[model samples]
Target: MNAIGIDELRGLAMLPPTASGHSPFAEPCLLLRLGGTAERRLADWLRQLPCPVIGIGEADAPLAASCDVVVQNEQEAQPLLAGVRRSPVAATVLVQLLRASESLPVADALTMESLAYATLQGGAEFRRWLEGRPAPPVPPAETGPAVLLAREADTLRLTLNRPARRNSMSVEMRDALVEALQLALADDDIRRVRIDGAGKCFSTGGELDEFGTAPDPATAHAVRSLTVPGRLLAACADRAEARVHGACIGSGIEFPAFAGRIVAAPDAWFQLPELQFGLIPGAGGCVSLPRRIGRQRTACMVLGGKRIDARTAKDWGLVDAIESSR
Candidate 1:
């Protein structure tokens, strides 16, 4: 199978929509026709294109040069199409292919046309874009410490690597965990997630070392008012799962509560000591936790700053179940 790196594809994919200004004789377009096996694949790559491309038989050879890339052979074309069927770039295939060829096979050509139209026109549809959301930004996978690896059968397992500071949620760890959770939500393979702290404790909370001087309240308010990630978390509320052990606190609880299920170790405890530091759960904990455990309970946990054991959490319905032991 022929494949192009995303970087190279980005560069090669910049062909213009129309070849009007260029020399009419110059070959600005390319034509692609695949044998039975590749019919779908050839159609798909064309669909991702921002410019239009026509089939060789439907239009004369003039449009073929406009095609920057084409699969001359059918067998090589199948996988590319199947892979791009659900992509946002699929819509641009026809924008990549102008009105040149009607002779193209009906089914594949129609599929390409539909994809092109959507990519070109679906920008204003908020939910459509959301449905095709991109991967969350995260750190490169290689650099971090390796710690606890949490896994459930057929579910997701995340290795909480930072064992040094009682597994406090370092910025790297937080961003990585968030990115991992987002990926799990997008993946059909992951049905549940297990979160365990490295070393002795489950978590001490956010990496206080990473917490800098607080941003100006006005600035913080302005950002929260916009509510970007919060809205995204709201949308993903029903899909993720978490299993926690040891000292789950602050952002530890905040992040996990977004999961659809929460299971903690028998000795594991829950707390939101953010109030003591004059802060609240900044990562949707204020909203998510209260919704699950209730306001009075959330208040007592946050304001009272008292620790609640796993069974107490189970009684309050904070956690779904307690693990048998460490």
Candidate 2:
């Protein structure tokens, strides 16, 4: 890995995209250390590069967008840089694809993510991880509703009901969530939809057992496009309020993020851990979170598998505010 200043980066950007075997874009990651402010226009050029950009210090507002992710100093960046080196293809390709989809429509962005995630799923990295971990367990049929719905006069309250599973987003849960959100979309009479969960955590993530069961990458992509509850939650975003508690992870945070307002309990923490399994945020997180916080911060979480506690989440605009424990 190499670190470059603003002036050198501008010069490097002038090179043609296919400028021989020495193209800067061919590297796994690059550290950008800007002593002062940078030209906002440079962000456009930076995004076009296929490599991951790590903003080092004093990134300033304008230059922050150009960084795929950032750290205040070099010491904090070692693990991230090492991760990029270990899985260079996933690190570089995932951010490149994420930046490309940042400005797209919600549905289109999700479809792009689904396709990319599926591609990664069938790749060597995911296979490598899968071979090492225990095979995901299969659970019996749901004996109860995954989501509990109750009408409170003008408001409809939806609760994630799978405490035993820590509210893992099973197929039943996704279907139930979509149907509930659709009601909000169809009826003007429903003034508000309050969504929360019933367990120690909102949801851990997607059902693990189902991870390797999809017949093929294409089929998985198609299924994700059809059943993604995040898209439906986005459709009713205006009327939705997600009150989350405990762990808001993977689909846990991915689903709630689409809500117009998200209030977090004191213990709430957010994370996106799909990358460890060589998958990207297949759940609309790439689209929704970047829209909420910004492209760089969202990339930081997904790429680094970092956790954001409630206070940090609020400060970063990942959540609307932190609420009292009550």
Candidate 3:
């Protein structure tokens, strides 16, 4: 809960040396408040800080890139970030990965995220979540295809068709999406690709029944390498547009984030609840989202476990426009 001023931070660097190389930021997090000029001057140094530096005061676009997360008021952030501060290693590593992923190719970035996610899956926090989770009942089998694909003139249309289950991203859906995306990639005649869902909600995230079913963390990573629709979506992003409505959780938001343009219906709401499962956004979100919104806001959303409505998504540049749901 304690915060350090820029002047005080500079002063500590001037302190007498110790044989053990004492670090002033012994706490799990470093809450920092600084004038605009001070932050800009120490930007490079702050980026290399040993602990997560949470900026206090109004959001500064430039300074946000240097910190793990920022809050207009530190008091407000204390409770919001309690989980992340408690699990400092995961949060720290997530932010570090987000920072490094921006310049990497989408495939490489996703690979990095999967490796980190697998590491966390083996950690105690994730194991605790899995232990606490009740076994899910078998969902009724739907009769039709998980996705619908149609080629219309020069445009390709893809829809998430499992409305009865809120279009949850099951393994079937993942494979279907990969096939649809692959079709577009192979056909030079397809100029525009439009993606949307068939029912009220675009997607409610991954299917609950599928959670924790992976044999092991390593196997999970292996499966994700082949099945992630986000990477395919990114490859075709140059000509892709997505229309999302209602609950856009987890894979819902992560997939659309790879599109060139995203339009949200008034009812759309977004959340990333994967941290509750003791994992980060393994669906290419750590890469896709940070490139759209800054790493700070993305970290806040994932770590804070908050819902962001459509308006907030637009303001944050997550979506290109707001429109009636298709």
TM-scores for every candidate against the unseen true structure? 0.49, 0.91, 0.90
lDDT of 2 by residue, 1-326 (tens): 66788887677767753351222236667787856556655677777666678888754645765788888888877877766665666676678777889888988888888888888878887778778898666664456788999998889999998888889998889999988888878888998999999969888989887777788898988998888999988888888999999988898998899999999999999999877876778888888889998888887887778788999999989899888751
Name the better of 2 and 3 by TM-score. Answer: 2
lDDT tens readout by residue for model 1, 59-152: 1232233343233443433422332232313212322332222334323333333333333333333235434445434433344544344456
Model 3 pairs in collision = none
lDDT of 3 by residue, 83-176 (tens): 5655656666676677678688888999999999888878877778778888877776677889998888999999999998999999899999
Give Cα-based local distance difference scores for all models. Answer: 0.50, 0.81, 0.81
Query: What would you estimate as the lDDT of candidate 3?
Result: 0.81
Q: Show model 1 residue runs off by greater than 4 Å.
A: 1-154, 213-239
Q: Which stretches of candidate 2 lie above 4 Å from their native place?
A: 18-26, 36-44, 137-142
Candidate 3 weakest lDDT stretch, 10 residues = 16-25
Q: How many backbone clashes does candidate 3 have?
A: 0
